[model samples]
Structures are given as C-alpha cells and as structure tokens.
Target: MKKLLFFIFLLLLFSCKKEIKETLDNNYYKKARICRDSKHSDSAFYYYNLAKNEYLKINDSLGVGNSLVNMALIQTDKGDFYGGIESSFEANKFLRRENDSIFRNRLATNYNNIGLAFHFLKDFEKSSFFYIKTLQYIDLTENKLLCYNNIGDVLISQQKYGLAKIYLEKAYLTQNSTTLSKVINNLAKAKYLDNKNYDPLPEFNRALKIREIQKDSIGLNSSYETLSTYYLDKDKNLSLLFAEKMLTEAIKNNSPDDRITALQRIITLDAKNYLNNFQHFNFINDSLQTARNKAKNQFAIVRYDVDQKNAKNQILIEKNFQQDIGIILLALALAITILWYIKRKKRLEQEKEIEVKNTQLKISKKVHDVVANGIYQVMTKIENQQHFNKDEALDELEFVYEKSRDISYEKTDTQGEEKDFSERISETVSSFKNDEVNTYLAGNDSGIWKHLSSKNKEEVYQIIRELLVNMKKHSKATIVSFRFERENDLIRIFYTDNGIGISGDVIYKNGLSSTVSRIETINGEIIFDTKIEKGLKITISFPAS
Candidate 1:
C-alpha cells in the first residue's frame, strides 16, 4: 500500500520538476534546481546566487525571493542553519504578501526550513511555531500532508504521543506517496509511547523497505538511527549492528553529527572493543571540529556579504525614487544604477571564485586534521603503548585506516552503583518524583527481593519503567502510586495514576506495547481500568519464578 502511494508521490514530485523548468528559460534557477537534485550542492549554490543576481538586476522581487529560498535550502542541508534562516527571513519580505501558488509554496518552504533549523538547535517550541506558520502558507495537498507529518514529529518530541498520532494518521491516510513512511513509523511510535498495546515492528520494517527501494541514502541513515534507538535498551548486539549501518550512511553523506551519534552508540555498546576504535574516534572528533569551525566562519562571511548587498540595494532604490521627481536627475539615477549593476556583476564573479577557493582550503585543513593526526596517534600507540597487545594494535590500526577512508560505538556506565531488586525499584520510583508527579512506593521493602530470580526482577523493572514512561508521556498525572503483593506462589502489582486517562480504546502505545509483549512471554496477565476524566489503574500478576 505504501509503495503504491510512494509511486504516486514520485510522479507528483517529478511533475513539479517539469513545471519548475517550464516556467524559466534555460536559466540559473532551473540549472540550480537540477544541480541540487543531482547532489552537486556547490554548483547549485553558485547557480542560485546567479539567479538572485539576475533578479536583482531587474528588481524582480519574486525571482529574488525564490533564489533566496533555493540558497537557504542548500545552507540548511549543509548544517548552516543560522545562515539558512537569515536567507529565509529575507525571502519572506517578498513572499509574504503574494497569493501566487508558487510564491506561497516558497513561503511555506522557508518557514519549514526555519522550523527545522530551530529543531536542530533544540528550540522545539519555536520550531513548532514555525511549522504552524508553514501550514498557513502551504496550498498543495501533498505539501500539506508533509506539514502534518512534520508537526506530528514536533508533538512527539513534546511527548504528546496521542496527539501526534492523530496528525500522523491523517497524513498517512491522505498521502499519495511513500514519503509518509515516516508518518507511519511515527504513528507506531506514538502507540508504543502512549503505553498502549501495539506492534510497531511492521511499520518500522515497512519504512525501511521503502527507503531501501528509493535508494535514499540520507533517509536510510535516519532509518538506521531509528532502529538503533529502539533496540539500544533491548538488544546490545542488534543496536550496535544498526548503529554501524548508520555510521556507513553518515560517512557517505559526510554528516558529522550522525557520525558522533553512531560512534557514541557503538562505543557505549561495545566497550570491549573501545580500545580498538580509539584512534579512529580521535580522528573523527578532530576533523568534525575543524570542519564545523570553517563552516561557521564561511557562513559569517556570507551573511556579511548579503547584508552589505541588501543595504546598498536599498540605498539605490531610495535614490531612484527621490530623483524620479526631476527628469534630468532621474536619467542620471537610472544610468548610475545600471553602472552599479555592471560593477556588481564583476564583483560577484570575483567573490564566487574566492568562495570556492576558501571552501577548498577548508577541505585541506579538514584532511590534515583527520589523516595526519590520526596516523601520528596510531604510530605513537604502536611504538610507546606497550600495554596494548600486538595483534590488537594491528587490528586497531586497520580499523582506523578503514575509518579514514569512510566512517561509528559506546557503553554507558551505570548511572550509579548497582542495587539489588528492591533498592532499584525504590530508586526508579523516586526518579520520577519530580515537581509535577508526586509519587509514592509501598510494600517495596517487604521481602519481595529475597525470593525472585534475577530474570524476574529485571522483567518487573522493565514493566515498571514502561509504566513510568507511559505516565510521564500520556497520563499528565500529578499523583501516582505503586503497590506490591506477595503470596506463596504469585506476585501481584498494582499501579494507579491521576491524570487524563484513555480517551477511547486503548490500542497500546509504544512502551506499553513492549511491556505487554514481555509480560505475555512471562505468562503474566495484566488489566487496565481507565476513564476519560478520572485516571488509569493497572493490575498485574506473574509467577514468582
């Protein structure tokens, strides 16, 4: 079903491609988009500014706005979020009032870019606000669905699982393309996180299959990360496996943030092998720092250039308007503006050359940081670090070499000293006792720890963890209680919370779904009593063994 929808989406996306070129001569705008689609981002950036300069020469506000948007897209993709937002803001001045569908679409895209930048910056509320603004300007059904999915993503970040599902579901049903795979995946997550009984695996697999079919390297990287996050707590080997996949894709795209996340996951999960990966990690860290610093300075320079251009253009416009009151002055003013544009064209060519050279120089520095330092560290380790076994050192050097050519692991220390079952339970409950949720634990120290197997204790811990996650995400509960019961052969637990309970049927969100799955495997039975306004209560019984 999703494949069919995605096929439809491909047609629509391509239709836009055609229309995009049809409206322009074999012009810079068309060329820029073609280059962008083909992943020639540097060329795309250059062409977009060529388009912008052409528009400026004729005072074509709409053309200039579109060029700015295209440039903003390039900047955003390059991780220069602040520069992208600045371009978007400048584009907005020309885009805001135009009712043309194309203009409005640009407006929507600009807002979405702003929202994504803020999201990456961890300002989620502001991000959500911009996404809402995007919705207001969006006109097409396909674009609207994209916004819905994006808004759903924001809601998920806020832990509004139920509400996020509503938006995601709407997008899923209306989507004409497989791009809503993310929406489907997010919907599954909402179900699990809402602590309802749901199987999110099918949707996850479905999304993965779609990305693979599409050959979407970036989206595939995201799929790997998503799968890795889901498995991190459940299966270390599997988590590391997916994180490794993420690392491969991240390297292909030269995405440092993804590299860090993938490497951190691998390191935490594969501590036994950290010594093997140390030199490679140092190389990645140093290279990332260097690349980011260069990008920061480059964006700063671009912003300065843009500000100067806009200020000068405004001055010219004001002069032209004022001098138009006199015929002779107006003629001179027009000639002056024409001459200025001629000079600007030559200046723009020089600036473009400088920009390309600057980027190349930065690349050289990044290479030095990665290769030279990494090789030095590896040599020093082999010669001076005698504690590392010879075979292990050779293996580690090979690992670093592979990484130098391409791309990502981690183990987390326990948050504190490990405690037995009872103490762990107490700490878990108290952990959730923040200002919002007043929580109490009863019968926790009542010999429950003495008779249970470690497996049973772990299962119980996971169940409680899932319960707490549910409460925090969905219940909006202020007061919560946990009661434990023990008998000759059976263990019983009761959990209740005061919050907005299930609105309708309980289709089990993500965390609760897994909890249910685990309990079923243990031959445990659980029941929930929920009312719309009152709250929720759960009762569970499982074997002591």
Candidate 2:
C-alpha cells in the first residue's frame, strides 16, 4: 500500500511540472500573437518582458533573444525608434552566439522592422542601410517582393521616381497577388511623378484589373482615386467618370478615409466644370473638410493612445525614482538634524564662554585705565619733589591723569555724550591725511547727519574711514577725493584716488575687505572701476528710503 502511494505521488508531481511549463510557454506565444494583431505595443512590451523572463528561467538564450526582437518590432511600429534600435542590438548580441539559420532570419526581420521605423522618420540613409542588410540573412526570392515594394515606397518618398519605378516593376513581377497589386499602383504613381505621363495609364489599368479580379473593394477604390487624379489634366470626362466610380466604391466599402479622398477629387473636378456645378462643389468641399477633420481627430486619438501608454511607463519610472529619492531625503534630513543639534549645543557653550570673557574684559579695562594711571601719576609727583629731573615726566603724568579722569567721567556720564558721527568721521580722515597723502572732501551737508540712524551712521563712518586708511597705506596715491551727493531717494558717495591703480587680479586684504563688507551691510551697490595707468574710482549708491 505504501509503495503504490509513493508511485502515484511521483506521477502527479511530474505531471504538474510539465503542465506549468506548457502553460507558461502557451501564454507567451499567445501574448505575442495578440500584440502583433492589436498594435497595443506597450502591452506587447510587458508581455515580451514576461516571455523573456520565463525563457531565461529555462536557460533558453535563443528564445529570450527572439522574444526581445519581437518586442523591437512592436516598438518600431509604434514609432519608438531609439527603443527599437536598442532592442535590435540586444537581440543581435544573443543571435551572434547562436549559429542557427532560423535565428539569423529572425535577426533580419528585426533589422527590417528597424529600417521601416527609420523610413517613417525620414532617415533615408539609415533606412537604406538596414533594408540592404535584411537581404543578408533571408533569401531574396522568399521575401524579395515585400522588400522591393518597401524600397520603392521609400525611394518615391525621397523623390527618386526613376529608381523607384525599377524596384516597383520588379515587385510587380512577383507571384504574390497582394504584393503585385500594391507594386503596380506604386509603379503607376512613380511613373506619374517621373513625368512619364503615358506610362502611368497602363500601370493604373493593370492595377485596377487586378483589384477587380481579386474583388478587393478597398484596392479598387484606391486605384480609381489615383486614376482620376492622373486623368484630371489629360481627360476631364475620364477623370470625372473615375472619380464618381471611386466615390461609389468608397461608400460600398464603408471606409471613411477612402471616402474622404474620393470626395476631395469630386469637389476639385466639379470646380473646373460650369457654374451649374457650384452648389454641388460647395457641398462636397464642406463634406470633405468635415470628414478630413474627423480623420484628423482619429489620428489624434491614436497619438493620444501612444502618449498615454508612454506616460504610464514614465509614471512607473518616476514613482520608483521618487521612492528612492524620498528614502535618501529622509536619511539626509535625519543626518542634518543631528548635525544641527550638535552645532546648536556647541554655539550655546561658546556663548557662555563669550559672556565670561566679556566680564573679565570690563574689569581689566577699569583697572588699566584707573588704578594704573593713578599710580603712575603719584610716582611722578614724588619724583618731582625729589628734584630728580621730573619736570618733563610730571607733564606726561598730568596728561595720563587727565585722560584717566575723562575715561571715568565718560563711563559715568551717559547723557548726551554720544560723539557726533560726522565730526568723528572728519577727525579720523584728518588724522589719516598728511603732506604725502592729500584728502579732498566735498558736499558735506549737516542735514545728512540727521537722516541717519546711529547704527547706520556708525557703519557709514567706519566704511569711509577704512577706505581712506587703505588708500593712504596701499594705494600710493598723491590725491584722494571723497564726494557725497544725495539726490531724490538715493544717496551716492564717490571716492576717487590718483593712485597706481589696483589690477583686477589684486586680492582685497585687511581694511579694504572690511570696507567692502561694511558697504554691503547696508543695501548698497559698490562699483569699482580701475585702469592700469589711470586711477581707481569707487562709487557707492544707497537707497535712502
């Protein structure tokens, strides 16, 4: 009983595995067929992905590559040129490793699909190259009729009507009835384009005969339409007859596109007729335009479908990228939060240290100014009493005592003791100037003093003082001029020096750097224009309001 149960279990397990593999293979082939029929190219891509994944799991490299090539065909049909190229290249890579004739022919089909895509893109050079390559692996006799027709179509689009006729003629000679009819129609058009007016009529007639024989209503409608166009200049009666025939066939076939073309031809021929046909012409023209618009809308829908599929793919990619970015951003935020907390803690500690240092500085300044000066003064007086040549020393001691007393008095008297900013600036400039460095000041207005806040006034004074000091020390200037002009809501300060001008390459250091920063502290634009042999001119403009 145990042995029988074991045998039954093994049979069931093997059957299940075979069924699963067969199911996967059948699904893959069915999906490929569906994709080819419906032109749902993105869906085709997804299915191709699934098919290739399953094939790879079974270690079928050739199957995987063939699946990729099939996906490339769908991409090419949907106008994804770059994608088609990439897919074709990937398929070729795998195909190179396989020495099978069938696989090589599959690679040729991929090349042909790529060529067709490029032809639609109007890249004739690349299209020709790949089309020629299609013949390398596949027998020309087997698929040459289709290949020749495509070559002729491309050539006709390129306006190579003469060469197009030869290829079309070759395609027309083929045994395939459908290819022969298409080739005949193309050959007729190529002949018309080539200015061989007599040659097109026979070709058009032959294509029409084939369509009639085959009972292809669509092809008959197309042939009649083209025949009507060819006879328009040569024979108006014949043209009108064919045009009416085309309209009848288009209506019978229930093809809006063909009906639209037929209506257009009828309308054109009606215009060239007598005034009695005017109303008919207008009616047909209106109907044709309306139909054309409808067709355009349909084309737009096709484009929209393609775009929607692409947008969905893009959304998938963007969603994945965003998830990754979100994770990275979360990590970055946590790291930054940690860094900020550490910095904040360090800053608080530094602030506490600064408070302690400030307290010590206040005590040290008091001791240096008051106690040290008082002790020196007392020592000088005692030396004078001893007649130790202390007269000159006593004068110096008295000056130090007076300075210390003023410091103490200033520290205590906090009422109306703030120095006038303009006066302070003037004194600093005066101290900086001498015979070697001449300083010129212009447009000093006392009203300008009242307009400034204490902080702004101090900043302005420091900026000016620092600039003058830099000019005296580094500029090597003989004459320095400062001009202040207040106009409207703007204040302009101009500083010019007849110095060996600084080059553009010169780097700012020390006081000059401080001056630049101070000017920037206020909302001002500083422009420095200098020349090698000329002078340096600095203009600062401040918005007064």
Winner by lDDT = 1
Judge candidate 2 against the unseen true structure and give its global Cα lDDT, from 0 to 1: 0.66
Total clashing pairs in model 1: 21
lDDT of 1 by residue, 1-545 (tens): 11112222332353355444424533887898789789887677777777776777666666777777777766766667788788889888766555666676667777888887777677778878998887887766776787787778878888988888888887886644455667767777778778746667788888888888878676677678878988887888899999999889888877777787788888888888897556567788888778656665665665455544754364246466554655677688999999999999999989877966776676567557765777788788878976868787677665566444332100001222245667878887899999888999888874865667766676677788778878897789999999998887788889999888774366374347778887887789988776535888888898887
How does candidate 1 fare on TM-score?
Answer: 0.52
Clashes of each: 21, 0
RMSD to the true structure for each prediction, in A, is: 31.9, 22.7
Q: TM-scores, in order shown? A: 0.52, 0.41
Give the CA lDDT, 0 to 100, for residue 423 in model 1.
Answer: 80
Query: For candidate 2, lDDT tens digit of each residue in 75-157?
Result: 55444556667677767765674345556556667677767767756798787677767667654473666677777877877
Give candidate 2's TM-score: 0.41
Model 1 residue runs over 4 Å out of place are 1-38, 175-177, 196-198, 252-255, 306-321, 324-545
